[model samples]
Target: MTNETFRALVVEEVNEEIQAGVKACTLEDLSAGDTLIKTSYSGINYKDALATIKNGGVIRSYPMIPGVDAVGEVMETTSDSFKKGDKVVITGNGLGVSHTGGFSEIVRIPNEWVVKLPEGLTEKEAATIGTAGITAVESINELERNGLSDKKARILVTGATGGVGSIAIAMLKSLGYENITALSRKKNEDFLYALGATKVISLDEFMPEKIKPLQKQEYDFVLDTIGGKVLSAILPQINYGGAITLCGNASGIKLETTVLPFILRGIKMLGVDSVQLPNEKKEAIWERIANELDKERLSTIGAVEEPIDRIEEIVTHLLEGTHSGRTLIKM
Candidate 1:
């Protein structure tokens, strides 16, 4: 791999401005790792969009590649866990932040950050699942562990149009969940319903003019992607012994709420961290997603596919909160 050149979406801070564009690079210029992979596919996350903007706070360093999710074939490896021609999937563990990441034609990462693509999933399918799918599965697993067993139990999914929410709703339906309510600011009720949401509630319709310490019991489970006031509003309506999983914070980080729901109703708030989760656990979730989620259903969740060269357009939409569903990036 002496002088092999490839294209990478390089983000650099020049004179206090963030500038990102696809640029030609070489193997030696990539971050040092035991394995070299030829990226087959990558996916855009909200964090990836933020990394391209000044003061976005997603990137620890500039002149870096900013993709947290990648699926590819191994080109070379010094690690015992992988060899040439093996297919692998990678996400998290400082990727696209502290470490140079996967928004490139090729990527080099530590083997520990790698999970061999499960047999049930193709590279494109796995990339489409990506980090968002993993987070959704993990969140559901946590809820299940907390006694979410009733198929008819009311479940609310916030930020319902985004990747995690959209995928979670579909996966839950496949698992025989009968009652799923989607909460979204966007007017995409048809899309959410197509993904099997039993009901679609606009954000305005779900939020009360005043948030009380406790409200009438509504949902038995809530999958919250947005934080801040939206999360604060959902807490009061959760049933006794219910649970809510907190994953993405696209709505803002600060959560203003009371512990009355916990103290009075025994509600549980589980925070999910997909990025720093152990590789072993990630593998389990990936396998579950690959096997339990129907490929045909997965294909429809986020059908938009964009090449790396056209990423800037999507990035703008993501930052503006106008984008919905997953967007797969072709490497």
Candidate 2:
């Protein structure tokens, strides 16, 4: 594959200004790694959208490929874990951040970052789940590990239209957990209900007329994707001994709340980070997504496939929060 030129979305800083576009690049331009992958699919994640912006803080260097997730077949390898033509998937571990990522037709990365594509999933199906699905499952697993039971546990998911929130709702329903409530700014009641949400509420309906340090405990568990004021508002209303998984900052990053909820209610706030999770845990989560997640329902997560060249349009939609569900990039 030496001297081979392929199309990749390149992000560079010219005169302290950020610029991103699809360009023809050779194998030599990629960073040094032990394995080479012929990319088949990638996903448009929120972080990937941010990497294209000037001050998004998602890219650590310039002239880098900006995709946090990829699914493909191994083209060459120096490690014993994979061989030529073996299908694999990779997410996080500095991809599109500190190193060259998966926005290219070819991606070269460390063997340690690759996960053997789980059985019972096609390349496109795996890419559809991508990092968002993994993060959503991780949040649920953390809650269960800490003491979230399926029986009679009233769960609330914020930002329910986004990838993580939507997938979490479906997965929770698949596991037989009823009484799921989804909160979204958009009026997509039909979509949310089809994803198994028993109730759908808008932001204006969920937030009270006045802010308080503590309110009536409305939910037994909260899967919060929108941070900032939403998180602050939800904390005080969590049931005693309940837990909240904080996975995203789509609404904002600032948290203005007190300790009364924690001290008096004994509620737990679990922070989840998919980008830096270990490979073993990632593989485990993928296996669960493949085996346990309702395959037919999982396929209905509103994924739309687009070519790599159209990534800019998808990025614009992501920044404006106009799109729902996952966007798969066929590399």
Candidate 3:
């Protein structure tokens, strides 16, 4: 593997503007790390899409690869944790952000950031789950810990068509939860229903005609991926002692609401961050995804496989919000 050049999506600053494209790069170009992996697959995430543009708040430096997720076989290692030919998964921990990421045919990452691929998942399946699925499982685990183990609890998942929301709904259903409502603006009712959402409602139906400090308690638990107004609006509607897991901010980041929901309703808000979570916790969640998640239904969650060279088009689709489900990139 000496002096081998590989194709990778490189984001760089050109004349004070951000530009990204596939380029030929050698092993020497990668940032120093403890392990080197020959990437078999990577996933297109919203954060990865933003890393391609100026002021996207994803990439911290220029001429960096922009994929936060990668799964493949180990080619070389300086650590005792892994060996050559062992399959492993890597995501977040500043990958595709402050360091060289997984948008290339080969990636070199620190040994502490890699997790051995779980037994039940294929490389492609693991990539399909990637960061989004891990976030979903983490959010659900928080809800369970807060007393959502009852299958009859009414659960609401916002941004129900996105990767995390969709996977959360499916996982909840698979876990025996009976009442799951999905909130989305897209007209993909059948798709959401196929993922085990018992009911699908549009924004018009979910949001009240007037924003209020408090509303009638409706949901026992809420999995919120769309932050901003959507989160504020849902807060007032949570039942007493209910819980809400906040993950993504696809809509916006600001929240303008009173403390009525928290002080009066006893509603708990749990924040989820998969990017910087400790490797052990991430591995535990990955194991849960491998053992508990319905693998057969994963393909139905809208994973489109693309080669490494075609990532630019998918990035555009993600930024435009026209893409549905996960986009798996094959190396």
Best prediction by lDDT = 2
Candidate 1 weakest lDDT stretch, 10 residues? 294-303
lDDT of each: 0.90, 0.91, 0.89
Better of 1 and 2 by lDDT: 2
TM-score of candidate 1 versus the correct structure, residues matched by position: 0.98
- TM-score for each candidate, following the candidate numbering: 0.98, 0.98, 0.97
Give the C-alpha lDDT of model 2. 0.91
RMSD of 2: 1.0
Write down the worst ten-residue block by lDDT for model 3: 295-304
Q: What's the residue-level lDDT of 223 in candidate 1?
A: 92
Judging by lDDT, tell me the better candidate of 2 and 3: 2
Clashing pairs in 3: none
lDDT of 2 by residue, 1-331 (tens): 6877999999999999998999999988788899999999998888899999998978877888999999999999998987999999999999888889989999999999999998999898888889988999999999998788865699999989888998999999988898999999886998888888999999999888777999999999999998988999999999999999999998899998999999999999999999999999999999999888887667778688899889999999999989898898997
Q: How close to the true structure is residue 190 of candidate 3, measured as C-alpha lDDT? A: 90
Query: Residue 38 error for model 1, in Å?
Result: 0.5
